[model samples]
Target chain A: DTAVSQTPKYLVTQMGNDKSIKCEQNLGHDTMYWYKQDSKKFLKIMFSYNNKELIINETVPNRFSPKSPDKAHLNLHINSLELGDSAVYFCASSQGTGPLGYEQYFGPGTRLTVT
Target chain B: SQQGEEDPQALSIQEGENATMNCSYKTSINNLQWYRQNSGRGLVHLILIRSNEREKHSGRLRVTLDTSKKSSSLLITASRAADTASYFCARRNAGGTSYGKLTFGQGTILTVHP
Candidate 1:
């Protein structure tokens, strides 16, 4: 079974349009994260939620929002999308919360294209 | 901004040859992990080395961590064509509220020819 899954593998929308991507993890993990990979292949963290509580909110634009209804699910919503927002978004989940290393399982990623 | 930067952005090797990749990170880290991502797929966890550990091995993958230098290396022995993928080193933040959060490197693209 797939441990982490994401919806809308590909999204093509016009500028100013709004879109949402859903992520779900079945690994029984408590921490979930959202990352954006730019055209240069630089993966940057955008947001993280631990047990449904916001933990890390990086310097992302206000147009992007992340909602975690539960520990197993975290969804990303982008509003007023611009051409610069064209990139691949990934979701990941981890089991523990501590200084000790915890392996994260990533989703297949959603490729968003704003025209 | 990325906290880690991998050396040798790309590597090409023949099948049965060993592949080595290095990663360097800034700041204190609880541990460093190696992940592999095939084209058009999500990343898969390969191995992790803690700050206190020196070397770790899993199957054909060997990982070494040097906390003093804040650097790590991954060696894949007897690499196969299927091993052609991007390798990334991620650091688990040790301080602040992002303890368990991971900071990833730019990744090294490896291509193995049969």
Candidate 2:
């Protein structure tokens, strides 16, 4: 079984479209994170949720929203997508918040392209 | 909001050779982690070295952390062509709102030729 998985590994959409990416982890983790990798391959944290509670939110655009209905799942929704939104999005998870929680498990990324 | 700065940015080596990548940060950290990302794939955790720990080894991967210099390094012994990938180091602040958050480095692209 996959420890972490993301649906629709590749997504292509047009500008102004709305889309969502779903993430799930079967590792019984309490914390999950979302990261975006730009064309330059620079990875940055977009949001983090611990026990379904938002903990950290980077300076992302208002159009981007993260929702965690449960500790095992985190989803990203983008409204009115722009061409600049084309990049690889990754979902990650950890045991929880603490010193021993630094190690993270990542799922296969979702390659999103806004045409 | 501190990010790790990886050195060389890119590296190339032959099979059986060793590859080393360095990461330097601007602030103190509770722990440092190394992750490897294959082309068009998600990142996989490799090693984690805490502030209290100087060095750690797993399989052929060795990681060293130097808090005084705010830097850490990853060394892969006997590299193989399959080891070609991008490596990144992430740092966690000791205490702050971003405690559980990880600040990643730009990454080091390593090419190992057979």
Candidate 3:
């Protein structure tokens, strides 16, 4: 069984359009995160949620928003998508907060293409 | 912004050879983690070494951390063709409210020839 899953593995949309990617984790993890991998393959954290509460918000644009309905789900919504948004979006989950020894498990990722 | 920077952005090795990747980060950290990502796939957790720890091992994978240098190294022994992938090092920022959040470095792509 897949531990972390994201819906619409491939998303192709035009500029000025809004889109949303859904992510769900069944590991009963308390923390979930959204990461963006650029063309150069640099992965950066965009947002994080713990137990349906927003915990970390990077310097991402206001056009991008993350919502967590519950501890098991975190969704990302992008408004007015731009060509620069073309990249891979990954969803990950971990067992606890703080550093220590928690390991993150990533999903298959959603390839977003903006034209 | 990227917190960690990995050396030798790309590596090519023959099967049975050992591969080593180095990661250096700025500022202190609670832990350092290594992950592997196959092309077009999500990342897979390889191993994590805490700040207090000096060395750790998992199977053919060995990880070493040096807090004094704020760097870490991952060594893969007996690398196989299947070991071809991008390896990334992520560090949990030490201070501020950003604890537990991981900042990843530019990955090192390793190609193991059969």
Model 1's DockQ?
A: 0.82
DockQ, candidate 3, comes to: 0.81
Model 2 regions more than 4 Å off: none
> Candidate 1 — which pairs collide?
none
Report the lDDT of model 1 for residue B16.
100
Q: What is the interface RMSD of each candidate, in Å?
A: 1.1, 1.4, 1.1
Question: Residue B63: error of model 2 in Å?
Answer: 0.6
Mind giving the per-residue lDDT tens digits that candidate 2 earns over B32-52? 899999999999999988899
* Candidate 3: clashing pairs of residues: none
Model 2 TM-score (2 dp): 0.97
- Model 3 error, position A78 (Å): 0.9
True contacts kept of 3: 0.81
Alpha-carbon shift of residue A96 in model 3 (angstroms): 1.1
Quote each prediction's TM-score. 0.97, 0.97, 0.98
Cα lDDT of all candidates, in order?
0.92, 0.92, 0.94
Which lDDT tens digits does candidate 1 get at residues B28-68? 88889999999988889999889889999999999999888
Model 1: lDDT of residue B114: 99
